[model samples]
Every structure is written in structure tokens, then in C-alpha cells.
Target: MKVIRFVLAVALLTTLGAIQALEPAPMERFFIEFKPGTGAIIEAGVRADGGQVHHHFKRADALAVSVTSRLAKRLGSDPNIVTMEPDARRYLAAKQALLTSQPLLQSDPFAEQLVPYGVELVQAPLVWDQGFEGEGITVCIIDTGLYEQHEDIDSSFVLGGHSQDPNSQWFEDGDGHGTHVAGTVSAADNDIGVIGVSPGKASLFVVKIFGEDGLWTYASDLVAAAFTCADHGADIISMSLSGSSGPGPERKAFESLYNEEGILSVAAASNGGNRQRVFPASYDSVISVAAVDESKLVADFSNQNKWVELAAPGVGVWSTVPHVSNSWLFTGGNAYQGEPMEYAPDGVVTGQLADGGMCIAAETPGDWSGMAVLCERGEVTFAEKVATVMAGNGSAAVIYNNEPGALLGTLGEEGGWIVAIGIGQQDGQAALDFLGQEATVQSSAPVPGSSYEPWGGTSMATPHVAGVAALLWSANPAWTNVQIREAMDMTAMDLGEPGRDIAYGYGLVQADAALQYLLAKSTE
Candidate 1:
């Protein structure tokens, strides 16, 4: 009897192993392409197989659902299903590594004028001066949520907004990128903070696609947000996010909104700095914007491709951020160079470097008194270097990079540093080369004022064009999306080989010129 029982147990275990082998892998989400008008049936099949449906697009005959790998395979096998793909994650174009200090209030608000060079470069101010500040026109910023309460952003201008994630607040900006983008598009012209391209008159709407933890979202959420904006009467939609994916259901939705509802869509060309196209920016119906610097030269970080439609200022762009003590750095004399830096400051400190502030060796007492000490970024923690400089009566400290490029650094609480800034390798070496020379280094003091900051990305360029589009639309509400796009393209300040090229598209967008062209055309 014992032998017979052992044989049965062995047979049962083998059968169970076979069953486990047949089980499908797990997948969090999937984009299931269904046959025309068969999405409901497929949705039922997905639910029966332990899957959940997040969204369904009847026009594209697709469903965005979550299922196990085995179930996805099973669904793909169904005759009603055309294809099944895993739902890919998309991200905001802003680079987190480039983030510096949060913008702090300054005691003298007028001391350092809040100048949006992009607005000036694009000549949007010319349109503003003509009394067309996107008045009565609505623009939807489809990105991370907007901080409606920002001093630069007029809350009354908001027409309402929605979020794909139910847990997210539609009006709050957990990730600072959205608020900055909003400020660029239409921050209030209230005279207290930085002004936007469209200024006080344009109606702003926020669609929170990204979650609070990070700047990431799925295609389904983006599609949903686009439709929500269309339903809410958005005349223009500005998207600063992208991914390397082929045309899908989202494209259909954007096309529908454009062709059927007459909404103009603008998206970032991406920050990949390559010819590889990213969508929905690559879509034929959406206008793709590239980034330019203050010089009207294409930014090295901006993506380039035949699909690029326009270029706008994107480097060192100052706009609104969540209110915080953002550290600012300024170097003077022959080594004067400015870039973003990170540090915990007790207060403002100013001084000249001793021995070019190269604290290569342990500093002697009184060596750094009444001066800002300079140190190379190696062989010590930022806090350790700052602490050593402070020990010698240093008023402030500057830590520079040993290699090329800029960096963000942190000095620990124990460092007791009053003020600190990080400089690029070239700037640091210059300071080191001129160690004994008389020069002054200044770190920005935290002033209790506004929540504006400077950031750089192709993401920042999209809004400048969008704001211009709103201004044009406000001036001529009867013009179609195609007409407006054509006017902008025709009137663009031609750059990069004197015609359309991958780098600058129709050169930098000329809002003033485009508006004038549209106005003249109206007479005909």
C-alpha cells in the first residue's frame, strides 16, 4: 500500500509541474488592438481572464488593459483581436539631472529684472503690445499638474482641469516642471512675478497626466487627457512629453480633436538630441517644436528631424516653480561664469579665494578669512571641504568640477557652511589658475518673494509657440488650425541653411510676423 501511494504522489506532482509550465507570465498593462466594433467583446474576454480594462478607444478599435502574459497571448490569438502590445511608459522631456536650485524670493524684485528672453526672441511681446494677449482664447497644458496658486499664475484664468490618476490633484504641481511650463505659456501679468508669453488674458487649463512621485504617464492617460481637453473647449493643447513609439490610438484621438473639433496641438521635439523622432510630436497633425538658445541657435540638447516644425528659446529659461529657497551662483572677474548650483545655506556669504580657493591640502587656520574658499571636487565630501574652509574663517565656499560639465552638490548639516556654489570644470580651473588674483564670488540669498525658477529643455520651448498660437487665434478666431500653422511656418525667421532643415525647422517661430501675416490675409 505504501508503494502504491508513493507512485500516485509522484504522478500528481508531475502533472502539477506541467500545469505550472503552461501558465502565462504576468504583465501590468497592455494595448490590445481589436477588430472594428469588437472592443466590448474583447473587453469581456479580458475580464473573464482576470484582466482589468483601463480605457477603450472605439475610433481606433483598441483597448488599453492590464492582463497576465498568458492572457495577453490568449487575447492575441482571438480572431477579433488584431494585435496585443505591452503598454509602454512615457516621460516628461525635462531632464532631472539638469535641475538646480528652486527659485527663491529676492529682496529687490526689480534689481534683477524677470526677463523671458524667449518671449522677446520670438517677438510675442510685439503681439502683446498690439493688445492680443491671447484674450478669450483657451490653452490646455497637458503635462504634470499646474500650480494654480502661483503668484505668476492667475487662478481666475483657469477654466478647470482633470487628472487621469484619481489620486492626483488637478490644480497642484507635485513635480515642478508643470508649473514652470504653465508660467511660460500664460503666467499672469500681475507685475509681481515673471510674465508669460500670453500674459494675463489667456485662459489656462491643466491636465495632470503624470503622477506625484515622478514625471511619467502611459499612452491611455495621455489620450484621456487629450479628449478631456477637447471636451472642455481647449483651443490649443501643449504637450511637453514624448516617447519613441509608432502611431497608436492616441494619434487617432489627436487627429479627431484637430479635424473634428478644430483644436491645435503642439508637442516637444524631445531632448534626446538625435534625429530619432518621438511621438505624438512626430505626428503629422501636431506641430513639433525644437529648442533654441538666446542666440537663436539650436540647442545641443534639442532633438532634430524632418518632423520638427518650429524652434524656440529653451536654455536657462526663468519661469515659475514651487515656492522654495533656490540657490543661485554668480562668479565675477575674469572667471565670471553663471550656472545652477546646489547647497544648504545659513545665509549669504561673499569673499575672494585664497590661493585661487584650491583647498587641495588641509587649510591652515585664518587662511580663508573674509574670503570665499574654492575647492576642487575630489578626495572630500562637499560638507568636509566647506567645513574646512569655515574653520579657517571663510565667509563662503565654491566647489568646482574636476571634469567637464556642471554638477549639483550638497553640503551636509554638519558642514556649517553659510553659502556654497558648484562651478563647471572650465570655470573652476579658471578660478584655480587665478587663485591669487582679487575676484569676488557671490551666492544668492533667499529672499521671501515669488516661486519662479530657471530650467532648460525642449519642454520649455513648446509653450512659447503654444502661447503664440493662442495669441494668433485670439486675434483671428475664425482661422482654421491649418491656416494658423501655415501662417506661423511661412512667417518664421528662417535659420539653418536659409530654409527648413532638421535643426531649426522653419527657423525660430516669429509670433509677431505670423500675427501680422494673418491680419493681412484677413483683409483679402
Candidate 2:
């Protein structure tokens, strides 16, 4: 009877889970524009059909509203209205991922200099010695809200900020994307935490367009935010959010910001890897940035196209986030792909990996002396597994998930255990092939402080160019935005298929080189 009841409960839970998964997403919205002098009648038509106006870009004659699909079809035929474009949500191409650390690793990154490799790669330090530390230059970051109180970027945030979502505060960062981008742009030059590429007097004006959890916001919202960037007297606008294509109104806003106000804009080339045309970045007014890694190799995920203008370090790039993340892993003279166990003791352990057959046995056949036990998760408590591995004289434990996801399981309560790391099932299984190989686990709890983490994306790459722009522009405040844009292109370290190829753009953006380009141009 117990068995039958258990089966029934499992089936019921599965059904309930499926029903929850099928819940509806938010309804679709559209961006509509009216022909010249037809706004009054077109708006009336929209209201007549149950459409609710959300954003009205009065200057550009555009209205962002929620309308039924049937109503959208009907509104299209109205002669007074121009083309109606769906208000697509542009997402942050930047994401956080722990890589295998092969081409991305080094011998103790913070040994000599604590600066991120991307900062060094762009040669920001060389320019800083010349007293061009991004002073008098302001960069506007348009994304999710910024975490105002982060230790690195507190004083740098300027003019407060505006949020499209009424509920969220511009200073509140539910998703750390904006905070990470801001840190990369202008974290304080203090000696403690990670410093930015332009770690100086450069100011940041954040415009929050997306809500707390949603990693995306409407193109209309982004358009509206750009104007906010301008209203605050921004010199450089950095856009890390992007969609497949943008509406005519959206394009008009960016063009106006560039052509009229003369604000220099940098954006991430979409991470499609395909040759798809990425909007906003593809716009002639904005400089499109592609992503390369520490090795200067173009990231495979970075979109390859002629629209790409400049390249910057994007893979395994470290900067600030809202939370604490300091634990790391390395294996076999390479950076390993794994995370330290949350409750594991603070220390580093390097040992030869030995298979331990689920690691739950009260006793094991072979001695695990000074070896890291590789065990699959199941049966016993995480503490018991580690205890058993230690009983067998193992130096440490490397637990892997039994299912699909990453095994972030704890050792329950702490004991005198050595370093232990939890990796996903795939990485664990792959680790099985090399049984005798050496793997190092560095584990530490988030006790004191450490708000920085490494992330990957063209989204990460955009801010490097933006920060470099701030550095160059601050050095030469009198230069126009066009001159700043043109100088980077002219001085970029050309890579890939020669001059201005798809992958590397002109090449990896060089800060010192751009300064030289401006100086040489001045002589001419």
C-alpha cells in the first residue's frame, strides 16, 4: 500500500509541475508610429480597438502599446498610421559561465597586478601614467538598474537614474548585469577590489530600462532610455542590450543622439555567431563591438559580420556583481570547470584524482592517500560521502551531480575536511577519463568580502570600448564624437582576415594606440 501511494504521489507531483510550467508569459506589445500630422486620428483608432498606450515618444511620433493580435492586424491597414513594429525585447548578450580555463587561464592572475586581463590587454595602465584617467568624461550605461551601494561604484554614479519600471529603484540591481557593466566602465581606483578599465574620474549615468527579474526590456523602453542618457548631458552612451532589429523610431532616437547631440555611442554586436544583422549596433550611428578572449582569439559565440567595428576582451573577464563570489578551481596545469562546495573549509588542495565508486562505502579497498576522490552524488548525505572519502585517507573530495545540473551540494556541517569541489555531471563524467590526472580545488566561503566575478559576452566587450573611449576623450576633451569613433577604428590592432574582418573587427581596441592616433591626426 505504501509503494502504491508513493507512486501516485510522484505522478501527481509530476502533473502539477507540468501545469506550473505551462503558465502564460507576459502578453505581447507593439510599437506604432503615425504618419505626419495624423497622430490624433490614429490614436483614436487605437483606443477604439482596446489598445492601451504605455509609452508615447511624442517627439518621434511613436506609441508603444499593448494590443490584441486581431487588433494589431486591423490597425495595420489604417492609412493614417505608419508601419507598426512589434515591440521586441532586447536581451543582455552578456552571461556568466565557468569555463574549462585552458586558453583562459594563467599562473596566478593577481600575483603581480590585481587588474583584470582585459584592462591590461587594452593597455589602460599605459595611458593612465600620462594622467588621462577618464576625468571630465561621462558614460551613460543603459541596462538593468545599478547597485548604487556596491563598494567599487558608489561615488561614480551621477544624475541619479530613471527606470521604465515604476516599481524598481534606479539604484536597485536585482539582476547584476548593469552593476557588472558599470564596474567594468568605472569602478573606483582604490587599491582593494577590482579596478575598471577607466578606473578614474569618469562618471556613470544609469538608465534602468528592464525590471528586476526580466533580463530584457522593450526596444521602445531602450529608445526612451537613450533620450534620458542625453538629457543628463552624457558624453558617451554604452548600450549592451540588443535585439534582432529595431523600429524606425528607435533608430531615429539613436541617430539624433549621435548626429545632433554629438554623443559617442558604443554597443555590443549580438552574440548570435551567425552573420545576422544586429540592430542598434548595426546602426551606422553606433560603434559595434565584437568580443575576444584573454588569448586574443575571437570568441566563437561572438557574432561575425561586417557590422563589427571594434573588438575587446569578453571571455573570462572579471568585474563587479551584486553578490560575493571568490571560490575557484584549476586542474592539470589548466583552469578546471567547477565550483567549490559552499560549506567546505577555506584552503587549497592539489591531489591526483582517484575513482571512489559512489564514495558511500563504510570502507574502501584502495588507500586514497593524498588523492582527490571523484564520487557521484546519491544514497548518502554529502557529509557522509566526504567522511567516507576521508576515512579512506583521501586528501579531498570532488563530488559530481547524479543528474544534469551543477552539483552545489554542501557537506552539511563543516569538519576537518580538505578542499572539495562540486561540478556538473558532464564535467564530472569527463573528469573520469583521466583518473590519475592532477586537479586543484581552491575553496573559500563568502565570509569577509569579494563582490567580483568573471562573465562572458559581447555585452562584456562593449564596456571596454566605452571605457577606452572615455579615457581617450578625457585626454582630448575638445575632440568631437566622430573623431573619437574614427580614431579607434584607425588605430585598432588589425587581426583575423586582415583590415576590418568580420571576427576581430578592426581588431582588439587599444587605449594607448587610440591616444596616439588622435595625436597624429591633430598634427595632420
Q: Write the per-residue lDDT of candidate 1 for residues 400-419, one digit (tens) a residue.
A: 77655444555533433566
lDDT of candidate 2 over 84-133, digit per residue (tens): 88987788888774432112342222222248888999999999999998
Against the reference, the lDDT scores of all candidates come to 0.76, 0.80
Q: How does model 1 score by TM-score?
A: 0.77
Model 1 regions lying over 4 Å from their true place: 1-25, 96-113, 326-340, 343-450
Judged by whole-model lDDT over C-alpha atoms, candidate 2 comes out at 0.80
lDDT, candidate 1, at 507? 84
Instruction: Name the top TM-score candidate.
Output: 1
In model 2, which runs have C-alpha deviations exceeding 4 angstroms? 1-28, 101-113, 325-450
